[model samples]
Structures are given as structure tokens and as C-alpha cells.
Target chain A: MRSVSKYFDGGDTVANYKLDMEIDDGEFVVFLGPSGCGKTTALRMIAGLEDPSDGEIYFDDDRVDGTPPADRNVAMVFQNYALYPHMTVRENIEYPLKVRGVPPEERDERVAQVAELLHIEDQLSSDPGEISGGQRQRTSLARAIVREPSVFLLDEPLSNLDAKLRLEMRSELKRIQNELGITTVYVTHNQEEAMSMGDKIVVLNDGTIRQVAEPQELYRRPRTTWVAKFIGSPPMNLFEGANNDGTVQLDGGNSLPTTAETSSPTVSLGVRPEDIALSTEPPDTDWTVPGTVKTVEPLGEYVLVNVEVGGSVVNVKVSHTDAGPGDPVHLTFDPEDAYLYDENGELVA
Target chain B: MSVESYLEDRLDRDVDGEKLTAILVFMLPGLTLFAIFSVGPMVYSAVGSFFTWNGFDIGQFAGFETWVATFQDDAIINWSNLRALEYPMGALPQNLIWMLVHVPLSTLLGLGLALLFADLRGRSVLRSMVFLAFTTPTVVIGLVLLFVYDPQAGIFNELLRALGLEGQVRNWVQEPQIAIYALIAGGVWVQTGFSMLLYSSALAGIDPALLESARVDGAGRFRRFKDIIWPLVKPVTAVVVIMSMIWVIRIFAIVYAAGGPSGGPGGVFSVLGLEVYQAAFSTPIEYSKAMVVALIELVIALPMAWYIASMD
Candidate 1:
């Protein structure tokens, strides 16, 4: 993909929707973003379903910007699973091969192979409307996979499944992509799914690429404040502060010492929930601030404590907390784990 | 609670007085009009089919004799030449022939045009142009057919002459052998637009994603239509067939206009509707036999009507 932008029917381009990225072959790249962020549009342009208003797309060394979708050799699984309602699962899976004039015997063999791979062997004879949503999704996957296309495009394919089924299919999809070694572009808004399944996650906001990095790198060092807040569950807590020499003073009167030097007078500080700890007494340590515990939520494996520091509230993830609401505590973190962003929300340190 | 009070509670539960009044107010007018205008004539015709009439008065009770006369009438059934399409031909077989030819031709042409115009750049203009024929009155269509199919000075013969096929040009609506086919061709022109509108709307309702998926699956345009568009629009085909069948069976205006009250040269263009009109208003006015032909048309149309009603 290269600076691919799309304009709809009335000639109005999607605001800020420009993409420029090179996805490695056999890589599972997830376009992660909120709705209307143009992730699906980008995938569609690559599939040749939608043409870019300005910019060229390449498959290997060939420019495919004007190619029809069929000649592009990209198979897409729609969010609704778009199975042919009139065809049986076997027939649906065999449709591509049939249309390509592949012999009937080979078509049947490929259909059976994909059906067994997707665990939909028993549903081959049933209509799509008669099957479960998970079965329908698997049938759609079988249809896309049976053809052995050069690239697999899935537009929120797992979104319509139930929560448990979605979780199950996430790993299954990743495993299949690993086995097939097909270059895949998956679009999704679910952050956790992107974290678990993608070889590299591309975070998008307001139709522009915010960052593209490995999931862990995206989590440990977000390139921007928007990505920092978007990539994690409960989100990264961001604070506005004034940078004075080597120390940053938060607007709420909390201060943290840092070694990075920046010319910006004001900055935004970010810290993940898990990176912060709660101490009952004011810890005599660097990067510690006094606060009062506001609320405590206990999950089986850990507890989430909301602590109020100055006029702002920050969530702290801990294993166990003896303190309840309204209790005084000190919030502490290593300065190295903390991120600093300048006035424009770009990460400076 | 007392027994009377319990009964009153059950009545109150079953029917709300205000809701009943509102239902009656909304439904009564349409129901009354339908009964008086539609059902009333049907019942009158059915009963009149069993009686003998002397112009304005009921003459005598002639039960099966009137039915026998209706069946033996040359205009209604033409018992002598049962299957022939000649002069003194039966209206029943002519109507059937019309339905068989006109319905399929119109439906196929309509579907083809709808698919052709579906994605064209200026599709709405083309669609309106095709659909314009449907809006033209059938009587006007008949007159236009007369002018177009004229053997001497018509555009059709002129084109045939220009193509050097002058040997094939003849009076299309005057010869009994080929006149029914000519009228049927005219019927197809008038009916295709309605079928096209039906199919176009159905085609619009399909999921575009399905087609996109097929396109990615390597299906070409024709394959996509055969595999996706046709199956999806099948129910609409059924509707168009039933509607066209009903229209051709009772068709009167076009045939009557082209052939006049006597059913044209050698009565080749006669249909059940024309038969009913001619029988009831001829010099002697055989109203009972007219009612019998009308009843037969109703019976033939009833199954289609029932099928359409049950579709919902």
C-alpha cells in the first residue's frame, strides 16, 4: 500500500484517510482502529473492490491499482460472512473453483479439504441460513481458503460471533494463517484481538495511520498519545504537565523526575495501569506521588484500584490491595516505564 | 365475584369497546365499497349464468341447458375444430396461446433489460424509456400496433422492404393464421416494462457484498448473474408470470381495439373477455351465455389469485 486515498460517490475524500505501508509476505497484519477510521476501505483498495482516488498499489512488483478484484487474487471474507444463501456449504466453497473452470473432481477435493480444516465437514450439505453463525463464518472462511488466493482479506470476520466463539476463532484464524503462509490483512476494532493475533498491528485514528509496530512494542511504547490510549484495555492514563528543566510537574501539582530533555514548555505524560503500584505510605522513592484510593475492583487474578492524585484519577493494577475506598496511598512507577508526549501528542521520550 | 360480574369481566377482556369502534371506523368504508363494486357483480354473474334472460327480465329457469349452450357456442369453445387456430376459433385456446407466448417473452425480455440497465451510467433514463410503454393505455397500444403492423404503408413493411425482405411482408392483423401472433407481439411490448420494473426492484434488494465476493471468487459477469442474480430474483419471476397470466387470460382492450367487436378477420383475435362482451350486447343479447364465459374466466383466474394471496 502507498498513500492510497479513496473518494466516495460525490467526490468527497474521507478526511485524513491516507495509507502507506508495506506488509511483508506471510505476515498477519491487523488494521486496528475505531469505526470510520478507513481500515476497511484500505483493505478494500488492496482487494481491488474499491479504487484509490490518488495513489498506486502494488502486489509484489506489479501495479494493481486498476486491476479487477478477481485478477488481483485477493480473497475477502466479509463481516456478515456473505455466504450464498441459495448454495449448500459444499457448493459455496466450490464456487470459486467452478467459476475458474477447475475440474469437478479437484473442486470437490479442495472443498472437502477446507471444510475439514474449518471443522465444517458436517455442515457441507446445509444451507447457510440453517447453520449457526459460527458455522456460517467457518463456511465463509472455507470459501476464501479453498481458492488459495495470494492474499487473504478479512473485514472483521470474527465480529459477528459470540464472545466465546470469537475468542476460539481468533487463535484458530492465526493458526490457519500460519499454516497457509498467506499474506493476510485483517481489519478490526477489537484491541485485544489485534494484540493476540497480529504479527504487526497498525493503529489508525481519524482515518490516518497512528503507528505500525509489533503488538508488544505498540503497547510498551506507543508513538502517540492517541495510540497509547487506544491500544490497551482500560486505556493508558494520560496527564498534562509542565516540563521544567529535567523535571515535569503535572497540572495537578504532582511531579516526576526524568532524564530526557525537551524544549517544549508543556507535555503530556502517559502511564499504563499495570505499570503503576499502590503504596500505603508515601514511599521515599523517585517518581512517587501521594494519593487517596477512590475505588477497588477485584478480579480473580488481580485487583484494579482507582486512586485520586491531586484533581485527577489514575487506575492502578495490582494483585491484591488491603486498602479500601477513601484510604490514603502513594502511587509509584519506574520513570523508565513512563512515556512523555509533547504538546502535539507526539511521543518525545 | 358474582356470576354476572364474572361474565361481564370476560366480555370486557375479550373486546375493548373503543378499539372495536376504531376498527369499524377505519375498515368499514373500504370493505363496503369492495363488496358493492367487486363481489356484488361476481355473485350476480354467477347466479345469472344459471338463468335465462329476456333482455331486461328473467325469462325462465334453464339450469344445465344454458351451460350446454355456452359450451357448444362457436365463439366460446368451437367444438367442431377443437384445436385449430382458424375462423370460428374458441376463445379459450386463443387466450391460452396468448398467455403461453406473451408471458414468457415479456418476462425474459424484462429480466434481460433490467440486468442490462442495472449498472449502466445513464440507467434511470433508459429504464424510464422502457417503462414508458407500460404507462401507455392498452387501447392506444392497439392503435399503434395497427399502424406499425400495417401491410401497405407501415414502418414494419418499410423496414422489411429496406432490408430486401419484401417477400415476407403481409397484413399481420388481417390474416387469421398469423393475426393472433401479431397481437401477442404487441401484448409483449406493453407487458415487458411492468415485468422489468418488478425485476429491477428485486435486483436492487440483493446484497452488493455478495456480488463483490463472487467477483473476487473469479466469477465473470455472466456467471455472477446466473449464479447470484437469477436465484435471488426467482420470486419476482413468479409474481410477473402470475400477473401476466392473469392479464392475458382476461385481455380485452387491445384485442377489441385491433379486431373491433367482432374479434377481427375470421375472429382469430377473440378472447374470453371479448366473448363475454359480444355475447351480452349482440342484437339478441345472450346475457346468460356471456355470464357463463365470464364465470369460466373467473375459474381459470382463481387459482392464480389464490397463489398470489398465499405468497404473503
Candidate 2:
């Protein structure tokens, strides 16, 4: 709810660092980054599972820096779905409430309501081992929901599911967030998951917030080159070069014209693979670069063409009918779509 | 589908043909010993209880008369001192001495040793020393205590002379009222090590998360032990209890080498196990009555053994 910074002494190499973030009410924010980015650590700090060496966390203006996990009123779903092994599905769902001393009558009523909501009423008497992975996931969801906690912490909850189940559960998770409307913080290394599921995504790297925005804004316009490179599949192609008046020059004798005002001697160039076009001859587009045909791979839907340009191999996803191995090719990428960065990997444009 | 043909086909084709025979071969030694020494004796005892016979002869049909004789004889009163009966000292009153010396004393001492050495850095050294007495030969154990309890020339009374406490150093083993307890002390010292090691391991196996959970649930230290630790250790406690019972009842060697029959002084301290020896193989062989006494012991112990097994 307010300024929270965590300084961790992660041994000699990265001796100290802080993770700072603020969450407003009812925000389905995601802490997104690659592994070892301390995104999970930050989320845990917010949930009161880990404490900050400095700074304060507030839940609607109440200092919660030292509150225990149970008293923090945040329910977490671990990546492995840490359901109680010794309990029935119903008992697993009812455990938090039972710990809080809720009466059996009210506990059962709330449990039944949640079981119905998750459609796990039939499996209530079954042990966790008897349920499918997805059903166990639902049981974990029901357990968190039955507590009616103020905050929901999801630590890569969908990462353990198979691809198909992950797809299905993503929609289910989004639906639940919409229905409950509790303030939630999700952590994941998957960019697409954060893009699709988050109302506001916090992109983190190396214990720092790289960028925080809605999905479309974060993708089309990233604040830093790390964000630009990390959030896209076959990530944004990046190279450090200098900007000429109408073109940019690479280390070897190759140059592409830039549309941005950068009179600096050094800069970084970034382009998404999807935006690059492969042509047998040069395409009559706003931007063109010479290249030698390297190779072509035919996936069922499209062809991935690799071209050696500016002493670096660049890939373009092309239509299958227009490409083959060892064909003469020129690569073209949109000039406006190019992102410029300073030497520090921060956006220059 | 003859059973032999099915078995032949399965052994010839479906099974890993060499594996079955190899496993049986590997198991032969232990299985044979178990059958001969452990299982065979149990089954033989149950079956042999139905007939009246000496150890080397053919038995006759008695149809529970042996069992009836076990209760009707005066030695039945001599076998165990039950609390319900208001009676004078049969050989029965001697076993009540076990309840006095071995019950809470050994249990508390074992628990105390386990707690004291539970966290020490050099705990294994202390444990090894305690366990040394347990591993010492029972004969040597009796001889050592016999030397310690000697009336005129013993090392203990001599130390008492050097310390000028000779009045306190009485003839401990020669006193009928106290010799049983003195011998029980030797067994207790040896046996408490086994229980302490067991309880220590039991304490370690308790889930650390359960302790944290109890703490978060507002459990204090005593409350945690009473409500959580006690129930989890109940099964282990049952095992220790049964082990004490068996060890106390079947104390053959300690009695044989320490005070023999008639308890070494007057006939003041003698329990059922030694009573059996005194009846069976002393000056006159009272073989028939000794067999009946052994039968009575089997009856008392069989129920306890069954309870221990079921608890597990």
C-alpha cells in the first residue's frame, strides 16, 4: 500500500540491494522477472513471509513490517501446490479457518460455498492424492479463498502445470481475481503469463524494478533494454552502436538509419523478431539492410529465416511459401519500431 | 489349467526364472533360524501347553488341566504379587520389588540421561560409556557386584572404612530384604541406556514444522509436550514398557550368577524367574512343578506381548 524497500545482504558478491514497490487497493499486480531476479523475494517481503532490512510496508496505512504470516492475512499458493498431505480435500480447504477458531457450523458453511465455487464438492471427502493435479490446484485455491484474506500471493502458481493445464488455469485464475477483487501479487519468470494475467505488471531484474505498467504499454514501449529483451519470445535483438545523422553504424562496415535524435557517440539498437521481414530481394519498405541468406527453418505455421547482417545473424519469422535454405535474402525492419538505448541499457529515446 | 502346469509355465517363462530361486537361496539361512529358534518354539509352546509332559518325553491328553493346575497350585500365589489380593508374602511379594525399583526409577533415569546428553557436543562419549555396562558379560556383571557386596573384605566397605562411613556400609547383597533390589540396580543400569537411546531418537524424529506450528498456535513448552509430544511418542513408549517387562520377567542369568536361589542371605528376596530355577534344577529336580511355573509366566506375558504388538 506504501513505500516498501527490502535490503538483503546476499553474501559478498551482491552485498546489499533493495526492492521497492507500492501497491494500491484491489490491484492485481505481478512481480515479473527472470529467475534470481528477487521477484519472489520481493513478493514474499510484501506477504510478510520475509522482512525488509529497511523501509516499511503498509496495508491501508497500518505498518505490517513485522507481522507474522498468519496475522498478515495474505494467502499464498506455492509453485508445487503445498496442500496438506494428511487431510481430506475438505479438511485441507478448512485448515486456515480451523486454525483461526471459526465455529464448525460457520466453517462448514463457508467451506461448502467455496467447494461449490471451485466445483470440488464431490471430491471433498477424497484425500489430496486422489485428486488430479488441476483438482489439487483448485483445492489450494479454495483453501486460500475460504480464509477471505485481504491479499493473495501467487508464487508462480501456474508454472508446475502442463502446458495445456496452464492455459486453462490461467483463465480460471483471472476469473477468480475478477470475482474476488482482492489485492493480489503474482510472481513469475514467464513474460506472457504476467502480460496476460496482470492488471499492472512490475518487471524486475537484479533486485530492482525495471519497469511497471499495463501489458500493452510495457511491451510496445519498455523503459529499459532489459525490459525490451526479457519480455518477448526470441527476445529483442540488441546491439551497441553509434547513431549517424540518418543511419546507425555497427562495429564492422554495416549501418541502419535511425529515426531518433541521438547525437551521442555510442548507443544500443533493439528490434523485435516479429517486426523484421525476410525478402528474396529487398522489400520496398521504409527500412532495408543487406544480408546473406544463412538458413531457413519451417515450423508448421511459419518459417524462421536467419540472415547474416552487419556481422551479426538476425532472425525473421517469414511465411513458409516465401523462404528456403540458402536463398539470397535481404532483411528489413521498421525504423519507427527500433528502440534506442544508452550504454547502461536504459532507454535513450 | 492344472495348478502345477500353470506354476511350471510361470516359473519357466513369465517370472525371471533365476531371480525367484536366487532370492529363496539368499533367504534360506535366516528363514531356517527363524523357524527353528523363534517361530518353532512359539508354536511348540502353544501346542505343548495342551498336554502334560516332561521336556524329553511323549505327552498325554490333559485338556487344560495343566492350565488349571497353574492357577490351583500354591505356587500360582507365589508367581506374581497382584495388588488386589490382601495376602502375606508368598514368593509373590518378591516381584513387587520390581515395581518399586524398576518402574518410575528406570523410566525417569533414562529420560534424564537422554535429556542431559541429548545436546552435548561429546554426547556419544558419555553414551558409549553408559552402554559399556550394558555390553559387559552378565557373568562378569554378577562377579563385579558380588565383589562390591562382599561383607568382610569387599572394596566398597573398605572404601567406607577409608571414608569413615562404615556404619552405612552394611552387607548389602547378604541382606535378604535388600539383595533383590541390589541385583535389579545392575539390570537397571544396563537397560536404561537402551531406553535413553530410543527416546532420544524418538525426540529427534518429531517434525520441526510441528513445533513451529504449535508455537504459532500459542502453545507453551509444557503444553506442547503434553498435547503434541506425548501422543506422538505414545507408540514408542509402549515399546519401551514392553521391553522393560520382558527384560524384568526373563532375568535368568543375573539371578543365576548373583544370589542363586534362596536370595543369598536368608530366603527374603526371590521372584518367579529364580523360583523356577530353584524348583527345576537345584539339589532335587522339581521338573514337573518348574514346568507349571514357566507355564504360568507364559500366561501373564502373552497378554502383554499381544497388547504391545497391537499397539504397534
* TM-score to true structure, per model: 0.83, 0.72
Tens digit per residue, CA lDDT, model 1, A44-153: 88888888777777787778878999898889999998898889999999999898899999998898899889999999999999999999999999999999988899
Residues B173-273, candidate 1: write the lDDT tens digits: 99877888888999998899999999999999999999999999988898998999899999999999999999998899999999998788767778999
lDDT agreement of model 1 with the native: 0.87
Model 1's CAPRI class is: medium
lDDT accuracy of residue A105 in candidate 1: 91
lDDT of 2 by residue, B180-241 (tens): 77777877887787777777777677765444433333345665566556666666777777
Candidate 2, after superposition: displacement of residue A332 in Å?
1.8
TM-score of chain B of 1: 0.90
The predictions' CA RMSDs to the true structure, in order, are 6.4, 7.0
**In model 2, what is the error at residue B132, expressed in angstroms?**
9.9
